[model samples]
Target: MANHVYTAAALAAAFFLAPANAQASPQAALPSAEVTTAVDDVVARYELPGIAVGVVVDGKVRHWEVRGETAAGSGERVGRDTLFKVASNTKAMTAALLARQVDAGLLAWDDPVVKHLPGFRMYEDWVTREMQVRDLLIHNSGMGPGAGDLMLWPEPNHFTRDDVIAGLEYLKPRWSFRSRYAYDNTLYIVAGEVAAAVGGAPYDVLLRREVFEPLGMDGCRIGEWRISEAGSVASPHVKRQGQWIARQDGEVVADMPMAAAGGVRCSLDSMLRWTQTWLAEEGDTPHSGWLSKKQREAVWTPHMPMPLTSRMREWNKSHFYAYGYGWRLSDVDGTAKVAHTGTLSGMYSAVTLLPELGTGFVILINGEAGEARTVLEQVLTKHFTAPGQNRTVAYYAEDLARERAAPESSAARQSSGAPVADARASAPRSIASSSELAPWLGEYRDPWFGDVSICPSDSGARFESANSPRLSGPVFNAAGRFLVDFEALESDADAWLDFANDSPDGKKQLTMAKVDPDADFSYDYEDLHFRRTGECASQ
Candidate 1:
């Protein structure tokens, strides 16, 4: 796993000097202090629990540093090699693995997924047959963003790769198949299985051999088991009571089933090597051969166009935004920018590449704040180009303000046996008691997410979901609906379970909605359709 290491002096020698035939700008080649100051300032202002920053300039690690602690409570300072969950950044690696299979002639990018894995399917038969391997990498599967994330988040599930594939058949599409771009993680799980079927090895095993070993990523590992064993990993934290607090060990484990989509963990050392490999002038490299020029180009080429309504474009001064294989492709200051971000419960990271300038940066944060992108913007400004005077800084400061104002951030205040201020202030005057909820006791089921049982307990009733025991909690009647509190989760929001006899048979159906508007959009409970089907409800 060992590869060449370029020291600062060696990097200066390799990149600052031009060939005898060509000229290079010495002024532009020297390292600048602007990038370091910007990164440090962002971390301090955001109160990020821990952060690791790595910059690859001209195929070498010109800047690498770790600042802050492994956890909020622990005073242990993070080392350069400390492992942090890269989350959805793993998608690019998955795409890279697929590229390798293509290079080996084991699979084609446009081949229908069914050709590689039998029994693979979606809500519609046509979609199942026409869904190509490339479709899996892009976000145009017609399923809404984070459509089925509840099945695997917060609490790890007993589901396997087969279970994930089976659940897809029941997931109804929010948009016509392939009509629009909606990010969905479930398809990536299917893509990982396709790699297994075509590569003749398990998904994790295939990646370790084909991607990690070849790239000299000695500290990198995929999935929960591998990550849990990786020593000296930075502990995840969440902002609570206006301070960062370490997440309990019981809830900090990675979602193993969703590994393909967002479960790779590594350090800055490995990430810098990865950045250099992708920024290779020519795609061919003796150290890594899985991604060819064409393959690399294919992933960076826009596969689905983005709506650009988001603030990301404004901050980066991008003309348009679109999704490539596993990367987000756009033009910042008329220069091609390729990047992707990753997020778990309390971990956030950003990996960006500037192919035109032969520069790239990887930022890993052990907290939930998405300031990585903000920090990267500053780094780009100092190294390649600047956005504008005071423009990016003002935008980033506003973002930090929003994160602090969010209701979930006052979690510690709510956890102290007090009603959430926003919830209490806006709640309706009339409170429905347990007696009013008598008609709602039943077992309900969703085709994709399985079942939930609302059974009578001493106080009110206990609520339990099939694959999500961590979401089990006490249910109370409030605002004419049943409010279930998931004590196991970090947030203080209550899940509102609304019931109605809208079914043709008048059998009563239940659908869930998050009462807190500030709740993370990934908790897409509103997508579920739960129908009553048990003797308890009949009585």
Candidate 2:
């Protein structure tokens, strides 16, 4: 078949290209043969335009490699300096810039937002005075879903960072402050502002001088891209219908002085420099004078836990969830993990490290790379635990298998990208017995939120958040009550606690007040619990 030949050629090129140049640089690694096999497999499977992967050990750049083309069909080979929009992984860089301020005694993690951005205030009167720097990075803001998306996304509007801060008056509270871990983006801007206000420099300038410069990320710079500049960037990708499609290029969030979350672009090699710095600071033999051990520890400590612990688990099989300052704290094979992930319209990014394992990794894709977090863990688990273990991201395995796999239902097809999903029709009926499922499923309502229903879905019972994959991963069980609870199931683990559900009336429903994990006023997720039947629907 044409597809089969394409797979073989891709595998051959992916394995032969870099190793041909870096010859044995990768081959010398453990299970070198197997790793080559895995890498080739992934390149062939996904048909990725290109991928820049780096592995760090101790405080040095250990392995760096790339495959395919940066623009796929184009002959543009991904070299050491190939620039990729890192999406949200840029948040960690933003956090590190903030940490530079802490090193100078400029700001404390507990400092209030209004300290630097004088115009800043939360919708909640009580919170405005009490909010802390860590609160914003910790996702405690309760603003409604897509509430702050207005601030950015379809081009950050003409609003300055100050404009976003000023608009908080109109934003409503989704839950009480500190009730749950809600992700938000606006908070990063504030954190950047706090750093800039104290450091006596703009946030972008401070980041370059303090972090980017020292790390030798000279190629790294902040984004102020124009519509015409879209050609310079890799296309952001999302899965639709049954294939990965390139999202149309849109205007870049204007060049704002605020340099806190989700700004900055560079190559995987440059990113590795930052990764090495964090990995060193996170490890025993740290890069001294950049961040004190205590300061770095603070970044890795549990500052907040979102209510949806269930979904965090699917992110990593070995670890439980807990947040550390701006970083999400997870444990793998008994190692502490200070990690963050970013999703921009056209690109996706992931960074993970096993401090105990003396390893850190970063994977970036211009298109939709489904679940790189799990793939990273899978590779690491084999790399360390298995004697002479070797594993790589396989791109074609599933497609090939599914091509010959057994017939699946229409819903299953949708999840896996089958033609059956293309012929959309009536919503599939629920399989769970209505009587037994009814008590657990009901018309539940939250006084502070909208009508939420707990009904059987294709994959069982779940909560939907717009159509964002990151927005909706944790599914809830049918409590048959007004309450909405997150499942402790590994498929959905929160920062802490499995969120063991218990309902006296089994009719209390809780709705998402804030889904932005990158906000300044975000709340801890586990702390949220609701008791209302009129606002949310329970299916």
Candidate 3:
């Protein structure tokens, strides 16, 4: 095990920042043996390709661990500076960049977004006029969760920032503006644009200058970079056929339109520094001069109420939950906690901060290890929240096991008194005949998503998106319901085609819903309102 510890003096000197006053005596050296054992158990159990864990206490990095290969069988070992896409954790940083603008009198949080981007518009004219800059960070825009995300992901899509702004005007709201919380990423992309317009630089340039540079976070990169030039980067992986498969090993870099929302990449060492900045005493860190106390407080202030999940209630005894600017605010045990988790196709990251305890930890992985991230997060959080309780990874793993088994316990009372099968089992297994699919074959168009066509294929029919090529897949009949099973393994979402009975305008209207309830919200198929405009064009 390679243990890397940064002293207060070293951090201060490296960043040219003042040391925060010690809040409490530094905790005893982290139990390296216990931590190692716990991490080993999780890696073995989940088959994680690579993971990096960093713990900070009293404004100093107390523990750092990097384990396994960057990609399964890649021969590249995980290192302190191995870059992993931090994903949505980039939101908090973007929020901070906005706060910096507020400090400089460039823009106010409550300023109408149209004041900066005159072209900005929402589906509702009133919302377009009323949306504030602050509204961009909180998830209360009335747009449903992950609304309009198809444009930003299955990455390397052709969508640009201007395209995202234009698409918002067509994203109909599910509720009244600010009526409830439903997380969406499109607004954050807009916020990044706002920052760029006001700061006289691109989003990535502004972030690097305002946030990364001042804090000495040299390992973080937002925009384009050659893979060969990017040192020691972790490769993303997904499980297929019970084996981990690398997603991309070639040298192709795609523009990240989602850079402001979920596109920053950073290493464990840099992430620990970022976490320390938040946990540090006010006005003590070097970048304190760049961001004002008022703005900092505003970033952490609750802006929207969030639903409290059963897991949070059971694990943290959380009484209330809410969304702050970029972080989720809640209480664990009785201590105030602020945190966020970032997820991409096969990457996962969790940052947990116990403000009252002056301690925090980060977990970064390069595989689809959501369960492992959860248990490991609980393990580290418990180290501070319930130190004497001695909850280890195994303990939390067992707890997760019990939770998974609970559904089975209630299966006896279900209709069949049997275990629930895969979600697709309820659909018809027989393939639909070509004639049955003939009526559905046509070229359809969505205002925001451009065009998708259902055309004849060897397998009866196929679904193809013009802008999002990864979404092309075969249309199958499960029972009688026609569904599209996307061929791109990374684009895991599959949707069912539901055609509306009445075509008031003489154009057959079709809508979709995810076949899997747990599909990532980014697969916002439900948001697509496709109208059959004409017959499919020749291939």
Candidate 4:
């Protein structure tokens, strides 16, 4: 009953805050009452802390609205300038900065990345030599999904952009070069470095001069230090104990190093400018002349095709899905829709551009609700298609209901943040004893992730990653193989360390895999090939 009341109150608050004061001056097409109802319904269903959506048509922001509070408990209302981490949406901006260099005849789209940054390398020498600047922006780098992400995801480290470049040779390729599309973030970081090298400034500085300043998006910023200094920033929120809790802090990776891939902080006000710039440029209306139409077309042109799941095929009715430089390209209802979704730790954001309609919208949320897609879809369908065509909200609501009602198991509970037999769990019970396990105890290293040591800790034998300190957890035997439970992580993404003696001298090498079926894909434990560097003192 208390939960019911909380839900009602939350919905009421959202309703009250639905039509915020932040409207696009000279609003072109305000969200109708129907759109408001749909947006409010989705927000209530997800119990999001807050969300801001901006709709722009023909280079004019038709509508901009903020719903919900700055956070779950904070009574502070989210205003037009409330800054939110715009994660991978930052990628498009990076591509734009690089495009400016191309516009100046400083860099070419097909120029080999190695030409710009000689130290750049991939797992394969041929791939490293053949990789073009365009390849860095596309997801067809032949690496697996989220490969090398462990270097930055879940925690911050002392890694620099140079470290990211140096670590590339170690990431094993899951596909042949340009053979298929597999989304990755590491290469984008490289792209940022390339832009910085060619532009004679840091990535963020380059963006400011090329993109932000020209558009007058003063509130938009790149590094964490700048984000902290921003006037008003939305607190990132996560659901805990059936309540939305705000994390009123910024992620370290969102600062400078990883900013190239997913770190961008901006508000609805600045994002309006950014989106409007893109819409204007799409219509041959130049703002700062940073990019030529040919360059813009190159960025929007589909570079590589992405496979569609059966559900995705049905959802957008997309015949094919491909990647533009930094944008995702697809056709919806026979109209080309260029889009991208951004997900930080707690913030979820999406930007959609319909060049054909001269329409685009950006939805920024403080919570990681999957329903952000539904909200944006509803808005898009409402404008582009027939009146009764917006059934995405219902479909997503049903999907969430089904997910919530599924029976719970150990794996499911662990995946959903229930306690696991973590590092704090009881010590090892194997008959093989500590001496038998000591052989596996050593400092293991991966090129991208740096180091992960299997060493003695207060909790017993543990596995810890150098780049991601929170990855430290209990290392115990399970099903005859050594396993690790990342107690600090809410998810059940445990790693399995398999030792082999394929060397001529019978030297052992450790290869890790996220054996848990429920592990987060970003964990990418399978990407690490750790050779035992030195023995550790046994626990």
Candidate 5:
């Protein structure tokens, strides 16, 4: 949210004395002029709040830089080391820690998860019998989208190694053992627990000892946010009511024990250094190296093929989009691109690397007011696309709209047309009164979700998960089931809705779909629909 003690004058003095280290990647021989064009095009196209980006090629970081305002409405410019919540990118860091520990003989890559904490078990009886440390790093743990998030959000609750193990019993394994790939943060949290247990220390503390401290990443701290001189460290901003406002993340989020998964924050430069270490040949750094050739090879291994690899390739048209340890593997510019993207409330960031080419870049952005995917895709398209090429990037419009509307969930929860039976969902375009929402408020249960309740209260429409934090939404649509858009989540995580309608002919029917299929993650958006089996009588 703010800068370090090295003031502006100090930066200027250092620039003069230290011959600005800002150089283009050393090995690629990429035209500096072309790099500038890519960055400008991305910044202008997405209207970013502010961004800090760095590129390292040929063993030197020549393009770590910043652009835009700290907050959209404020004149303050983003700096080199502003703390950013690198969302799921935290997975890579946590994975790296595991890799390092494995390399140092502190742990074994194939060790059973229960070996570290005897409390470990699995939801699928088969998984418990066959699970390994590598499986945890892979997204094959079978935990659902947010299996354990309930324990970490709204209010920080206590869960032990046993709690994580017990979650295994409650899990509904989507894939047959390791047959598919699905991203789950719950496994990474378990990884952190294993790291701590194996190292006989806190995971964050072990991470600093193994990775951060030796890498000269003195400024970056895991879990603990080292406030830059001021607490108002360039917070991510979101557009609320057409105005840019600084967004504050949840107060309870910091106290989480699983810093390895999504709790870490660090500056852009620190991030660059971290990735640079991975790109080093066998982790033999220009200074003291921490990783090795075997370790690096292990980290980059695509241990398992992703589920529906064809579909993800169709969407990206770049990489195969599989999990390689802590990174997402894809091909970019004729090189295998290993990358990770992060999101936590208003902050978003991504780091992409082409290790074979020794060229990698990290883009860190502040403010959830915009989409990190677009912001990052813009950054990549600018750099990887041919110079003066007329490659028109085809981005889905509905995705962009959801990114712009996320902070203000009120506007998106509205219906666009008259209710239709079994038609696509229409989110409430505005808040719905209890009377308008009452007919739809009730308990919904699926074999997968168990039981979730929609209740109308004096305040508004509230969604209560079986034991998860309450997510509130304003009525944005009413086409089928009523949909409410949650104000704070990345990856467009929205709820589906179901409603009962009695037509002019006195015919009764129940229907449900995503609040808006147009924005649903379903491969075919409009075809996305969910039917209701019961009515308000079930509430």
Candidate 6:
């Protein structure tokens, strides 16, 4: 297939010269056959259950290519109107809502968080007092990445917004306030509460009235709403034993405690409109009115420096990367790119914007297909950033093959004597006898997260959480190390249970960490510090 790369200068000139109303007109050309072919190849290669791709050029949705079933065999085809959870992409919209509040003179970015939520508090007293509203959006809170996320996920949990807010004071910081960059979702939840406190309405209500309604993003849904009323919604899927299985049935009737951080369902049409709002220039009627010129700039401006990963360096030759309010700001191949990716269980979404060329694209997938998203993002981005280069699915497939075949790094080899596959195959799968599990049997408690009970089960030992019910599972022994194989398959976050060597005062304490290092950071099992409080309750 021929590469349909457009030069940045040429694309920018064409976009600027086009009539203002051209954005809504159907004059823009559709995506090239190459783009469609690439999307098909990725879907086939990754076996993604459903995907919705939308491209916006010259501030208009120029093309859309939706394919596959809402669930693997449900036969409900994904359409432009089919809602998929955009996850953390909702953060940008949350930031926009705060910006609207700022525009209305209701809140300032630098205002202390306590000014809005009087009871707001962080781990450190001084840090809590000094923390500003903008600090909540940017991920420089000194907390480790995805800290305290266990309270928010494995959904249908009992944790509430107040529980999340109150838990903040107990989560110990990894570093001093504003000392370095570390991504966090809990703070964004706090930001949402701040918006609600100032806006005199719930976060979802404020989002609907201030952003969604004004921007015509009618298909987006948040907070508590029945699945039946959701119209066409995509089910989240995960691959197990080489088969794609639906996890959640797209029912979100219960309130999402982390809704501000990552719980918004949107259709391709609505996402395109949201993208267009950001692509619009200052004084561009509805879009510009969404936020003042200053706030618009504020949301996109880089606030904290992000470490350049090997992927970013090699893929886009990106020099620097940082987090803005709700977006990531970076220069990709000499063109400024503002973007954010949302990942939740089996749902994934990415929104990329090239402001200089007035172009952006949204990729929403209702499956565990992060690799597919990466391949598509690079292929789409390279169309403008390095148009001359043809990086297709085949290219990425070969690249990934090479990466997989390469030997593990020295550091990796040293960390684990044997490969993960080898270790899993050789290790014992279950506890030997009930007597062996006695030392670890107890009701343990963490400060932020509530209670976890380890008790003898019919099979062996069982692990259960009080606040997070989905964490219940059988305990497995891997090379003398204890691990919890969560019964909730959708979570895919099995964690190792490590006990402290010395029990001061005869009290046992344990720490948990993910068995798979690459599991979602939100698993955050390593952040948990559980102390054996007492014997497990009757059951």
lDDT of 3 by residue, 1-539 (tens): 10111132132122222232336433423556666776888888887899999988777888888898888898999999999989999999999999999999999999999999999999999999999999999988999889999999887677888889999999999889988789999999999999999999999999999999998899898877777887898989998889888777467455578999998989999999899888877666776576776776787776676767899888888766777789987777766678999999789999988766678888999999889999998877766776677787777888888887775433553553332334563656554555787877888999999998988877677888888888888877786678887878454487788886477788888898887655787899888999998887753
Model 1 residue 124 distance off true place after TM-score fit, in angstroms: 1.3
lDDT of 1 at 67: 88
Error of 5 at 326 (Å): 0.4
* Residues 129-248, model 2: lDDT tens digits: 898887877776775433454344433234467766665665667778876556777777777777778889777778888887776786676745564543344555554554555554
Model 5 bad stretches (over 4 Å): 1-27, 143-165, 225-232, 249-253, 283-288, 307-321, 369-424, 427-456, 459-470, 473-514, 517-539
Report the error of model 5 at residue 383, Å: 4.0
> What TM-scores do the predictions have?
0.85, 0.63, 0.91, 0.84, 0.72, 0.91
Model 1 Cα lDDT, one tens digit per residue, 1-539: 01121132233222222221111123224254556666677777787888888877667778776789988868878877888889899999899999988988999999999999889988899999999999998888888677778766874666666777898887788788767678888889989999999988888898899889999997787744533466668878878789987764542454478888987888889988888888776533566455676776677767776666445565556556677778887666645577888888799888887666677888889997766556555445435644234334445677757856776545776674333434542455343444666787878888878888887766767788878778788886554456777777766446787788888877879888777754765677877888888845434
The parts of candidate 6 lying over 4 Å away from their true place are: 1-31, 250-252, 410-426, 490-492, 501-505
lDDT of 5 by residue, 389-436 (tens): 423323433445555566633234445232233343333355556677
Model 2: per-residue Cα lDDT at residue 125: 74
* Candidate 5 minimal-lDDT segment of 10 residues: 520-529
Error of 6 at 104 (Å): 1.1
Model 4's lDDT to the true fold? 0.73
RMSD of 1: 8.8
lDDT of 3 at 218: 91
Candidate 4 residue pairs that clash:
224-255
Candidate 6 per-residue lDDT, tens place, 1-539, comes to 11121232234333323333323223123446867887899899898899999888886677789999888898889999999999999999999999989989999999999999999889899999999999999998999889889889988789999999999998889888887788999999999999999999999899899988999999999888998987889999888889989875644467689999998999999999998888888765456676777787778767776766787888888766777889987778866788999998789999998777678899999998888998898888887667668678879777878887888775676584422432552476766345677887889998889999988878888889999999889888877778888887554478888887466757788898777766777898877888889997754
C-alpha lDDT of all candidate models, in order: 0.74, 0.55, 0.82, 0.73, 0.59, 0.83
